[model samples]
Target: MPIVARANLSPASREEHLARLESATLEYPLDVLVIGGGATGAGAAFDAASRGLDVGLVEAGDLASGTSSRSSKLIHGGLRYLQMLDFTLVAEALRERDLLLTRTAPHLVRPVSFVFPFARKVIDRVFIGSGVALYDTLQSLGRRRAVPLHRHLLHDKLMTVFPALDGSKLAGAVEYHDAQVDDARLVMMLARSAALHDAAIATYTRVIDYVREDGRVIGVKARDEETGHEFVIHAREIILATGVWTQEQQEIAEAETGLRVLASKGIHITVPKDRIPAKAATGIITQTEKSVLFLIPSDEYWIIGTTDTPWTEDVAHPAATAADIEYVLDHANEILASDLTREDVIGVYAGLRPLLQPVSKGEKAASASTKVSREHTVMTIEPGLTAVAGGKLTTYRVMAEDVVDHAIRDSFPDRPSLTASLPIVGAQGYRELTAQRSEIARIREYDLVRVDRLLGRYGALLPEVMALIDTDPSLGEPLEGDERYLRAEVVYAVRAEGARHVADVLMRRTRSDYEVADRGAGAAAEVAALMAPELGWDAEREALEAETYRAHIAARLAGEQARDDASAAAALADAPEVPRRA
Candidate 1:
């Protein structure tokens, strides 16, 4: 039988989690308290909870609202790290990648082939080809290969593979495989799995300061960002997984020394897939002056981006400037049959990478932000407080295990982490359920295309969505003004996925915000109406939620008009926030 995991998160669960924190004290404290709700933090909660530890996690915003959601959404062995000669990182990441594709999240992650167009004939093939060969070799070392091996394509074959290429500037191409994932969904699933293991999970709860003992960290003073209610959470050990905010969090704990983390900004723009014709290709990547440019596929649209530069502005609201958008378009147009203009862009987003500096060498080792390693670092900020930062989405599991291991090394010395072998909430029966997709759609009276899409998102738990439809047949209809998503999805985001605001349901729970031209503004009122009754919001509150969603989108659109990071961030500052639910 598949592992039984049917957990749900709602406002009631949030209240329960908060009560657990409020009731715990010195005599009865949680074994581990995790701060941050991004990928690594959620993973740490899963790791600790699975090991039979009393775990409690708190987040300042919705899950994956930070760097976790803003990723390129690719899960690979860090193909770029091979050039840096980080063989161990590549090999370890490859193992994890295979695990996700096969064992853990077969539904959310799938292999994507990328063709690297050759600029020079011999030198490019010999150098880049050998590097790709090594990338495959490392994957072969794992128990099983998640994706296929690399292949070299001649002129005719390369053109057949990717017809969009200009063909005039390229000699040939080499194709290799990597995986893409639903970044925010993965984090949410991880949190749900942890909750199933008896972990107390809370979001929109910010840790204000450390509750310390005689020169040792013991607990935290926190506030409910949604209600402004202050409380204390007592824990034996506190794990800080606050990516770019690591230093800021350390200051709150009043630690003597901590890991020095620098913020590197990366941005992505979405465009209609038909704009760039690729008859036989999933995507393509090419070398850029600063970083490698990727044209990855995501559903109906293509996600193309990634400008890696130093970010000295706000970490909370990273926005893509006009210059950043122009840089991506120019690079993408370099090899495309037709040049892309600003009108081709459907949406844009910017996220910060926690570029961790080497703890051994201190903070001044690297001058360029691009030169910094994407690897993670875990340090004992003090006696009982530990902080971890850096590392990409591909290696979040490893980072989680490492952080949890640090938390329990002295306390639960005999316990071991069960995450590597344990499947997440929706992974166990996912394949079987997928085989029954047509039957599922037939019984539920859903479109075949709609069922297929939801399966990719929910896996074995697709039935849970069906159950929602059974209770309220109206939810089975397409989301108002956004036919791409079902109304049930919005309701699920609240009743099961812990979405509190309209933005939470529209943006993170579903991709309606970025996948659409208006960024889901047209659907804001409808989405708010679906969530209002579930969240106990009055008519005025529902209107406020809808307006806040629209205002935030306006702020992002205004930010996109800026040419620099400072101005873009300033524009984003005008974005209205979700009001406290007191």
Candidate 2:
């Protein structure tokens, strides 16, 4: 019965959040407070809120600005995990994958098929066939039976489905179904949905210290990164889901209770659609050397090359080197008929993964990034603080539920999780709404693809986007350089999505920065100018935003030329700097 909408994140909303915090501090001492704004944190907030617990979520930066935004964006039951013979892990992830595609967020997650091209003639088809079969079996055990099972492809049919493949080397391929999602948008929506359930959600707010009493963790001493104001709000419990930054949080918690976290970095590159022929399909390819490669199709470009390397420098922005790019291109090119080079690459991003560590000897030489682990661990280092680590994006819900369960097992004796049946904000009537997508296009005065795409990302919330177009018809026009996105989305990002700067609008809200060839430079100034009035910026602010975005683009370009992290980070030294746009 405590549903709130459109949180009024206006100046008024900030005051309301503070007032709520103060009020809740005085009443019942609150239930749970979550830290970090990535996928797991957002997931934890939703889980706790749905369970009828008083919850507050604090993020030092924008939601999903870290590794969550830098993911492969696939929501599949990791097929490779099946090879590891981890059935329990595969089953749980598949269940969540089904929930996202069918019920929890039908509009945000969509089914995508991948083709695993078999190149060796001596390799038994049954060996690869059995793995695909197990992957399909896991899908049936999930809540939604929407995705179809894997099918064997004949040599002729495989070539037909992917005309670009060099059939001389390829024996045949297997086609299987998985799902893809807009990872950043999903986290933002989860935070918004948790807010609707009365969870306190604030971005650009950092927890500087944990306030402890005697031996129990009580609350936190935090500062608004934007305004530099410090405040305290005592709570019954805390949950940390900071992703790669998990170790830093543990250090802070360790000050009081001694816990540790390890960081692993994963880097991904984006190339033009033309670089990879359309027939490659969006699926995982296991190289002869045992390394896995993902050829994913994004809205406007093909995403390729993800190097798993240990990282120890510049955690804020992981830099991709020339060597990293070469390694990826070298492996991926082995299968393609038309080879790709440096010119085809458009964007590159890297993120750190937080893996639980026992501090192995020679950990540095272990290997490339460990295959993404399906299992997650939750630890209560002290009386009121809980830390979770080592989970994939697909299984965030289960991780969240477990974290909350550990946090409140003693405090909230009567509460049970309601998130399993709870629908995210845009999920209401999603099927029926999709059924009316054609009609909605008529009423919204947009093409069927545009309307459906918007609906797909925002779910029942397409009305919010359409309402902006209604106010200014010009807002419906596509962005200056990117036709796949509409100009009106810029206005919506600031007004409703908590996008504070141009980078937020380009990099996350729209993804035009990585998807477009020019890295969204052509549209940056126009978008900044349009958002100025809404975000309360002057001419100087607009100019600053434009410069900052241009620098981001240049740094990424320069990063490609460097052979290692030192040169890569140095290349970005003069690229341009802006306030962190949360």
Candidate 3:
């Protein structure tokens, strides 16, 4: 097959997706209409589209704008689950991890190692070591190699690997391999992959109500969150992949959905890499009196905190409590000789996990959010509506395949799943494309590092990015502030990756929001200016974009200084009010 152009996902691309939806409307009786543009929703779209079925996916915000982008961004078998003797969850995640790291979405997922500091000498070492071994075994058992095997380290050897580690009371460390991802990018890729397979995908579209006929869900009434234009989408099958908001969606459906999804808030704080003394992929899992704490690493910073507190307030924006911050710092301080203060923090984010109601009594009530089942449940709440709840990021494809399979078995009764043998949009001949990297750099007259970065992130689609740079050599230059990103990256993000706003470019497409000190403030104006032509943004819209981005940076910085959530929210006082646009 011929190489496709960069997946145009800008307003132009949005127009294309919208056009596809209109075309589907003419066709009538779509096989699947997916709600929620999260990982599961995107994956379902891909699965359904690849199976020769008409599909439409709608999101209330930007793609991966919710919990999907807010994940810890790891693709791995749940090592902690092994402690609870949940072998099924571990095995399934391992298989998915293998698929992502190797065959399906290699451009977005790569292996990352973690060093678990051994505090105790006796049973803890044996127990933890056994778990890592089992984790490695599962990966090898999979069709593709997810990551390398785990290795044990002595105290002195561990110190050698991580020189900045506080040596006092450190017995040793276990080096185990998992995988890390740009979570938002992965979700966007899934949607794009679906689009490549002829799926209709739209962001900033909200479902206002369900269309019911004779006590059956037949379609939906949706309004563009941006434009406020209501349109009816009629589908033979509707799949709900909105996490945390599962119950709310069920209420809208008015179906006797027995499944109850509870939301638990998890907060993560980002600090500069230097703030943490240890360097060799350190992640601490502390056995707290009630729960466990994680200190994982992002590409540029250390991600700390993740308190599993039951939430009772707003589901859209879950705020982190002051106690949550204190809890994390206190636990991390136990291991570091030089303690971290509130000042060292650079970014803070919170996400809610969708927990499924357990069949066994007290499991639903007694379980904290972290302890709840990450395994998903698929149920036909009504004749045409299927609600899929309670799954982790690593297993999204499996969840999607399962959801589609259910629809086929009950509704269509003829189509079989073809997603397992199918590759995503960027996966075709990726290694061969990498082999031609020198020629690519020579063609673009760019450095190896810059070209490699694009290839790794965009895979075989790197040439598409380079072509734009070739047309305007100025696009080959690095973006301001975050010089690691090429100027063409911003263009590619909008034109090909379906990015709608400045936040989509910074936070998801490039990760400048998480990587840079100023959280992408320095380059926001330049990016907006570059995008103005394509988005048809006049002076007013461009100014709005710049101001909104600047305000977000200010709010995030101020939030770091505040001691509590109220103070943090107060810090956003200067944040520009985002003008609603269709």
Candidate 4:
């Protein structure tokens, strides 16, 4: 990795980015301007910038604050898609998965094993075994093998490995490999990487209207959510990667022709790893009546999710209703030796997937969200505007390339995507840092576990965060209630990552939103106070941000108590909104 200039997206740098966007002219406008700040949008920004083109990206909220942050956090090919006979999506996703696991983001993404248990001896094994074989074959064809091939295990052997599994109905099981990442952190890093490549990255900037001349889309009219000030962001081309809100953005742009996306709600519940024996079981998958059930494993929790149902309520405030929780628990309990109850759930979240609703060549126009194709489509919404929808987290880079390549191929110079070969900021020197984790801990005189956790979160950039500990040793102390997150991590989030609000730090920058028992309510004020100096906030502002975060937390909890989506959404009617900074 040769020396490439890097920039931190702090308050000052964010202002500079906004200034550049505000000052952009039609003649000297940005080569490409990307709308949306989810994975695909961030990926498009990085893709455009890495191609040596001038680009600017604007987001309606914090980075990865949408569907990007609310994923199953897996970077694998959808194994279920293989059963749908959608091998093209499976193969494309598998290649991207291996690319992330092996080359692009080895630090953020690592290989994890999954157990796909069979319900019958003959029929189940034969069909699923063939699918698993094809899955491995797809990976091998595109890139170097990044994970081990699937291997079969007998019923007795699997029971030894997964005692929590009800062995009475189990015929056998197959263990396979996949990869996972901190989904929100990946988007933040992507934006930062784009900035490193000279892309102007702006968050909390909502596009209010389009800037068009004659027939082609030229720029956009956007508002600064923090200040309630509106401005123009002129560009040669505009691309929309807004995930579940794709249709809304399209309607707002008045494109008349674009993607028709159906919002599908998926919810996940987090439980203590000990309660579920997630470490012993690794990750488990089984077929459910509605969709495939997955027990995703993380460091300290088991993330069990998700129901595939249509969402017609507010797109911004998707909640895990009581019935939704019950559905997940009942389906999961069907295979568990010891059943998990609502009492075991420490945190719950809901996310909407933008499943493309178009009728493809061989596929019928699916009636259910689950039946829809996960394959992404890129098309010109207008002469100078391009919009993309449908895709998984694993294939965001590919989607970025297709959209950007389409937007720029006719207008701008020809330069292919370099993200496949380029590493994100923290990935370059990661392995060496991991190897010296203990030595780094000894040098800093911090606990080894803390050093390990920091390394896992920040990778090669651990030193930058640890440097804060040197100036104020107090920052090294644990957060008020959540010892898992250090005070320095919250401060680093405000200073380096674009954490404009308290929720941004708690929910996205750190996993405290879903990882902690109280959803970071206890540490909200402390985190806000730590962020005050970096963001030039007064005491009143700090308290306001903290209170707003608390109110939002209360709304989420209250919503979880409701039995239906209508009632759950009503609980958020009073969910506090972040006020104008001025």
Candidate 5:
């Protein structure tokens, strides 16, 4: 593999990106300006820049702060879509899944087996077996092998594999492979890779309006949410990958983008891994009164969720109500021998899915979000503006490719996407590093497990993290509260990963926010102090950062106790906002 040129996504780099954003002009228009710094936007920046185009991307919040961070964290070919007879969507997602597992982000994405327990006997055995068989077949069509083929397990065998499972109700089980990822980290890596390729990227830079000339979008008027600095970013082409905020962006443009996105709220709750008692990532497809429920296995925790219902409230902060928690618990308790109560849940999160509104007349929208198609659509909102909506996390790269391809069709007719073969920042040489993990651990004076953990998170970039440890031996020590993460990781988040706020480091950069029972409150002060120097924060500012994060956590807890969305949103509003510069 060839070594790709990479850039550090540090505070210094963010300053440079902001400088470029402030200086953009119509006379010197960027080849592509991407809106939304989530997965798709970051991917588009990388895709366009890798193809030798000058690209710039802006995000209102931290990368993956929206729907991207709140995903189920599974990079699977939507297995449920197959039941809807959407084979094309499943195939495309599977191809992308395999690409991430094998070529693109092998370190971040790895194969995880899912045990789909079946309660119904004859009908389910035939229907689900065939569906999974087709799922495997589609994966085989891909160039690389990501995971093993699906296999049917008898009830007796299933019980042996999953002792915690109450096999009394289960007739059998079908075990299949899918992939899991740290979704937020993937977005950050994409942005970092784009920066390496010379694409200007800035976060907390909100697009206030479009820069229009003759009814065509040539750029955007943006405001830095942190600094309160507003400016114009000139670009020859603009792509919107704003997900649930798609319609909002169109409204700002004041042009009919010919796209309508309905926001559907999905909420997930996290518990300790021991609470679920699953050896592998286990899931049972049981019908809820409203939708299906999935109990996914993440590292050190079991994430069970998601209530799919219409969300008409604020998209920025979708709160999980008491009812949402009850819904998940009620459905999850159906198959488990031990019932899960509210006390068992350590963390709760809610995100909105942007479902493309069907256009045909007389097409009644289904009340259940499961019925909505996961397919994406790209449209020309104007001469220079293009927008994409309604895609899943697994297909973000493909969505990015499509949006960029469309946006640059007329301008750069000959240049094609190069991200298909491009490995993300940490992916290159990851495998070799993993093979030498023990040796590296010995040299670094750390245990093999610690080295393995770092490799999983940073891949071949582990050395970069280790360099921080070398400079400050205290960084090698475990974080005060979370032993799973090192103090070094927190510093690296600020120094090399463009983490500006305390929440950005604890919540997205590390899973400490949800992985631990305290939701990162225990480590908040320490993490904030570590980032203070890098971000040029005074002692007062550092204290405020810690206080803000604590308030945010408290608000999230209060929201979880609320009975409905309205009350939940109200409770979440209690959190203090980050102070902006005047």
Candidate 6:
């Protein structure tokens, strides 16, 4: 089969994908049916399709709406994992990280430096420095070193590197490199690449049940959440990449024997970049009572997080409690020149990591989720059903390869994974476009900074977005509430990026939600009005969409104020749910 170039995920493409889903087995069954739209699922779809396998992927919500979008956004070899002495896992992740930075998605992934601050001089320096040296060594084992090696800095130099640090501590620091990315965009690019390879990709499509015959799973019964239409998609093999919802899916399928997945809720708070007086993308690794915490720096914000506590709340909306916020703020403030309070936080987001339930019995069973292995497991639950769980974002490509290779082991025994060599949708000519960024900016009459931002987000696909601007000069204007985003990007989200809801554009397609103080509430109405026509929403529907988004933001803020998870859940429950299409 020849590769086709209709890679756009416009409304028309979604309709086409839905039409194909309705007629899946009637025409012919797919070789593989993937259930998830996260990094793992998208990667699997692209991997399977690239190898000439007929595949279809379904997600109950927007692509990367779950944990994939809420990550700390680093692609590292897991320095903490090295403390556990997991050499193989670290090497594999480093290899995948290098592939992404250099070959697969250079535009989405870039090199970032982190400062490992040390308070206890000599002992701390040797301990952290040795681990970082090992990390650099493993990265060098890859085909190319995508980032720089680790360097040692004394207390004075460390203070120079991060002026935000408290001089009272007056300790040395180790600077090391890791790759960071827009996690949601990476998943979106994967799905688009899969669609370009002829894979049927459908979002807001929920798998209600499994299609079973003679005790062997054969396909899935899915519901199109957009139109409330139910359909059966037959496939020779089914791969379940659902993360935190894996256990729920297992129950729906009535799979008595399979890997059990536990959900560990992690939350991150975003503060304005100016609050952190840092010239570079700096991160600090500190030990929490339960697990380690990370304070990673992004372009215009500092993402401070992550409390690893067990969660037993609604999976869709994991609320971040006052305790969670305080935990992060307290630890993060420990090393800062100025303290960060709840008032300083502009945005907060929570995600659940789908950890595999450890096989330990009795008292050992009470181990913290952090102690659970980060390695992924592939299990053939039944004749035609396969499921994968417990891997990090950096190694998603390898996880996809493992799942696909296992699913097709009997059918296509000789076929090997080709994703390592395949550049995702926007990566093909990215370098050339980046080199010509100044020329493109001159021709388009935009500033060099604007063009550079576009290249960072779109890469070779920049022309496609520029075409939207050319069609409507108004699109070239900045969004009303947030000057960092262009109006054209909003239209592009709906017209080309498979964005079906107002929240999708605000939260994922653009960083308006977390970047601004109002949590995107200020831009809600404008965005809804812009998307109304394309999504076929009437005035009332548009109003409802805008109102629902505001409620969501309000609820999230209220949740953050609540003292505990239960109270946070109640506060989050205040948000009126967006009515799905019937």
Local error of candidate 2 at 411, Å? Answer: 0.3
The C-alpha lDDT values of all candidates are 0.88, 0.77, 0.78, 0.88, 0.86, 0.87
Candidate 3 C-alpha lDDT tens digits along 46-96: 889888888889988888887888878788788888888888899999888
Give candidates' CA RMSD values in order.
Answer: 1.9, 2.7, 3.0, 2.3, 2.1, 1.8
Q: Give the top-scoring candidate (TM-score).
A: 1
lDDT of 1 by residue, 487-578 (tens): 99888889878899898887888877778999999999999999999999899999999998898889898889988899889877777546
Task: Compute each candidate's TM-score over C-alphas.
Answer: 0.97, 0.93, 0.92, 0.96, 0.96, 0.97
* Candidate 6 vs. true structure, TM-score: 0.97
Please tell me which model should have the higher lDDT, number 5 or number 6.
6
Better of 1 and 2 by TM-score: 1
Give the runs in model 6 whose Cα sits over 4 Å from its true position: 1-5, 360-367, 574-577
**Candidate 1 CA-lDDT value:** 0.88
lDDT: worst 10-residue window of model 2: 1-10
Alpha-carbon runs more than 4 Å astray in model 3? 1-7, 22-27, 142-144, 277-294, 359-367, 436-449, 557-578
After TM-score superposition, what is the CA distance of residue 33 in candidate 4 from its true location, in Å? Answer: 0.4
Candidate 2, position 462, lDDT: 74
Q: What is the lDDT of residue 201 in candidate 3?
A: 85
lDDT for each residue of candidate 6 in 41-147, tens digit (9 for 90 to 100): 99999999999998899999999988899888889899889999999999999999999998899989988888888888899988989999999998887366888
Question: How many collisions between residues are there in candidate 6?
Answer: 0
